[model samples]
Target: MVAVDDMNRRILNLLKADGKLTYREIAAKLRRSPSTVRDRIRRMEDYNVILGYAAIVDREITGMKADAIVLADVEDGVSVRDLRKLNGVDGVAEVSAVSGDRRVIIRLRAHDSETLDTIISNKLIPAGLKDVEVRIIMEEIMRFPGTS
Candidate 1:
């Protein structure tokens, strides 16, 4: 595992809060040199600990009025990549292939529940997914790599 020190954790926390923060800005907040912060960030990236940045937008404000957690029972020949390309699939946040009743879990967004239903009943069924169970996401309580 990649060893992350307290400084590294602090840097990650800062980035998580606002990814657009410049290296100099982060350095100022952490009371460190810009080069030091840069080096640490580079090392984290090298270790694959620091993934790319994303803009966390409010779905309601973006017209994505609906979101769902879809548990798909994929057949033997089904591909996860194919599922990701389906229409109205704003994001394929998670796809886990495990030994269980459901093969994959996917998070997706659409303009409304009707659109989501159409995407599932029309698109997913024909794409070799044997069965699907969908649950609307009410709220996002927590996300990964949390600051605490």
Candidate 2:
């Protein structure tokens, strides 16, 4: 395993903030040589520490005006593999299993409230999610890195 020392951690933090930064830019910020930064990044990539990169788009511009968090209980006999299948559903951004009264949580996005309702009713419910509770996201105060 590659040691994620202080330098590597700093490099990761810089990349997390802006994945488009070049090795030279990162090197300048961390006061390290570009070759050193490049080598560290390459090592991390080889070990799968850096899974991939993606564009963070504006939801409004993409016509995804509505966003909601759906918390529900998985019906008896539903397999973990089946739960993972929810990720394939349109507008289902995230699907997670947590320990709570409601074990399954899903992040959904759609064009409007009606469309969001349709996804829950037609898609999620039919797939075996029950006792569903949806909380619509009013505004995004902050977003984590690497998520659109």
- Per-residue CA lDDT of model 2 for 34-112, tens digit only, reads 9999999999999988888878889999999999999998788985458776767889988888888998889999999
Model 2 quality (TM-score): 0.89
- Candidate whose TM-score is highest: 2
In model 1, which runs have C-alpha deviations exceeding 4 angstroms? 1-3, 79-93, 97-99, 139-148
TM-score on alpha carbons, each prediction: 0.74, 0.89
Model 1 agreement with the true structure over 52-72: per-residue lDDT tens digits: 777777777879877888887
Deviation (Å) of 111 in candidate 1? 0.4
RMSD of each: 3.8, 1.7
lDDT of each: 0.78, 0.90
